[model samples]
Target: MFSSGHLSFKGRGEKWNSTDDGESIATEISSVTKLEVLELCGNSLGVDASLPIAEAMKKHPELKKALWSDLFTSRLNTEIPLILKTLCNSMIVSGTRLTVLDLSDNAIGPQAIGALEEFLSGPTCFALKELYLNNCGLGSAGINVAECLIKCHEAALRHNTIFDLQVFVAGRNRLENRGAKALAKAFKTLGTLVEVKMYQNGVKQEGISALAEAFEDCPNLKVLDLNDNTFGRRGAMQMARVVGKLTKLQVLNFGDCLCRRKGSESIVMNLAMNCSAIQELRLNGNEIDVETAQKIVQMCKSLPKITILDLQQNCYGRNWSILVSHFQKPFVDFGAESDDDGSRDGDTSEEESDKSDED
Candidate 1:
């Protein structure tokens, strides 16, 4: 941690959980400024410790990234928003260089989201690019989180500032259909996203349909992970239709997403027809049979760019090899050249084959 571009005090044990420990560090490094990154997670440091650190951070004129996640347990209900505002104001006063903010695993609920409303609504623009709010107790009822992003988008656009956000991670937050709809609305307003992770959010057909419509706005999207969600046939079909619009998508993970034959066909057929750049596709445990597996193999073969295709834990039985063999095509070359000369450079082993295989 000495003289490095990043600093971490996470999981420092009970000894450094006290306010005195924080004050001592702050005092010792009060003159040091301009940290590129700082992480103080899992310290259980209460408000008293946070205050000193926030005060010390005021000297960092170019603090680009910071994380104080899981710093409190019960105090998150009241302190989450306060600490956010404090850090925001402190950065603004010093110099607004923030890009990523992680507040995950904090047990944050509606109140904390509500608390962010004022900050998002403020005239000061924040150049945030990545936001991580995973497992923060924002269930199906918590639409304020979506609203906060909407406000941020609106404010940044009106002010002509950079809201070029890319990655948004809210996985395991239990954001069901309604919450997904709210986020979709926000997505319609903003379009500079690249990756989105919303695993295990309990989103169904209605929610996924809304998201499918919103996918039209994100043309630069490359990675999308919606695994462990129970979107049925209708939802899968809707997603397939819209996902094809993202021609640049390379990685897609929807394993265990409750897809039947029709649903899986719709997805694979659409991707094969429209998205040819996809490299990795994961549809494990989707109840796929031999017919569905054959369709998947045909679709995969249609795309020359396909690299990894996962169909494990499905109902393909012994016939799963039919699908696996498509992606396992042996490397071969038609042109044959033999360097049988003993004068060849670095030919130390006689067991080496003269022929080389190419894709």
Candidate 2:
């Protein structure tokens, strides 16, 4: 395969858990000096076989992208933080152009998140972008992780320069109020973050307040996801106050948030009143009262920038089509998922996994 030179797995993903014989494949991969992208996610390989293969790719200056999903590889027996430290100090430091890091479903806890917090929180990570930390089980109940981010702020902000950011962190417990509060502090410090997801964490009123305040500063924050959380009336009200301030907010998903229609009304009206930046809005799984649905439909009509509206699972389902018809321009139905428009990237994938939490 190395001699053939048709080395392209560009769009292939692991729907089938095919383990290409590690020895020969690793040898071939190690020799390729011009590889632009490499993804070794979700295979049942041991760290004993994977570490050397990853280390071998370090020599290639042209290597720019990598996806190392599934944390069980390195965390089989070792503590997660130590493994992250090792990976960051070794592979991350050498790849000057490396941009994407997908560490989803590895179950890295608050300790690992805290350890990597310095690596990503401040200015030390300027050239890097696109971080996926989904299902890592971040800390939700304490302030240590949050305090650690504040402690590392100066250089973490100065060096962790990820201008083109697209972060995904979900399906974890550590994203509770304290953990989320810590993350919000770091978000405020960042310069050019664009997208974020912390769905299903226990991010209550205080965390949303912090996020709302931080949201005012992030000039590039366009898409945001806070689905399945505890951000309720006061939190939604806080989000309402500043939701319009984000001139680039295109997509928003607050699905299944136990919030009453008032919360949705507060935010949706706030956005409709001022933010021409919003293109897609999701109120799915909320117990939105019919009055709020009517308000949404009325407001969305004037929103020239809006292209997609999702109100599925809201108490007002049949009326969903009523509001949709008033939209003169093309708009999505409740479950329609257009191109990377909203947070989920597609309706089916998000619906199936919408119940899952994030941070």
Candidate 3:
């Protein structure tokens, strides 16, 4: 019975869905003003729909955040700039005070990615905390989003504009060695980022290792998502090795990664033993079995760090509790009894959280 105020669209009995569902959310938001957060995912609403929202937003002038993440959307074969025309024209993208934008799994052209350079040059993007362009077409083109970020960071520095951020999850957006280095270079300079997700990009071991080095120097980033980026066992071990050096990481998702179970376990245990800073661990879809779970348990112990654990769609069962009991981290989305057998518990099924919180 809600339109634009606060709406949660979901199927019955399906718990632990990610709030990234942007589809089928039709709110009578025309008259509403002073919106705090707007999360509509996969709704197939182009930039035109944003005109009304933008105009209304101009009046409300209090809209803090808006998430249009479409995790399941197919890549747009066009270039990145064309896709972003709507954002540049009428939308919350260039607005001030707006934070957190997840445009994951879209095909964004490189030129389009670069076009944002002009946008970021403006004062609008100063307060942005998270800007997710994962799985976007930026990777498809010879261009690299990591490079764009680097350019943006330099622009911010040159302009002397205040920029602070916590999360910058924009992976699965094809980043090769040069591009990854650009990101790492930017990180080395800025100490604001806390969590960075870069899984499924074409980052090689060398590139990840570079990022690890940058992270070690940066002093801020905590959580990292580098799963499914073609990081073989060696690459996973190497990337985890990078994180092991970082003591602030709280969440790490290595599910269905290129690395095998052994490699992943090594990374997890290493985080638990050495880092002791990680809290949330997501290793779902990696095909880890009871044996692997046993190893994970022996390594993971009571610490103030670890919390929410996701082992769903993998191997662990209800008995898996024994391993996670030492730690206070609550387990959800275990997928032990899930009919889908592919879903996880407590995990954001979609990109943006359907859950609207002040944060």
Q: Rate the local accuracy (lDDT) of all candidates.
A: 0.70, 0.61, 0.57
**Residues 143-247 of candidate 2: C-alpha lDDT, one tens digit per residue:** 554454344445444555324444535545547666776677767765456888878776766777888887787777788888887666667777878777777
Per-model TM-score on C-alpha atoms: 0.83, 0.75, 0.63
lDDT tens string, model 1, 1-359?
43565776766643344568668767744655547677777766555665676688888766666676776665646766665666566666666456777878877677667655654444433577887888888885357867777787777777788577788888898898889999888777788789999988988777888888887899999999999886677678889888888999988888878665677788888889989999888886566665676668767788778787776566645444544555444221111112111122234221121111000
In model 1, state the lDDT of residue 241: 87
Candidate with better lDDT, 1 vs 2? 1
Clashes counted in candidate 1 amount to 0
TM-score of model 2 relative to the true fold? 0.75
Q: Which of candidates 2 and 3 is the stronger one according to TM-score?
A: 2
What's the CA RMSD for each of the models? 13.3, 8.0, 11.0
Error of 3 at 199 (Å): 2.4
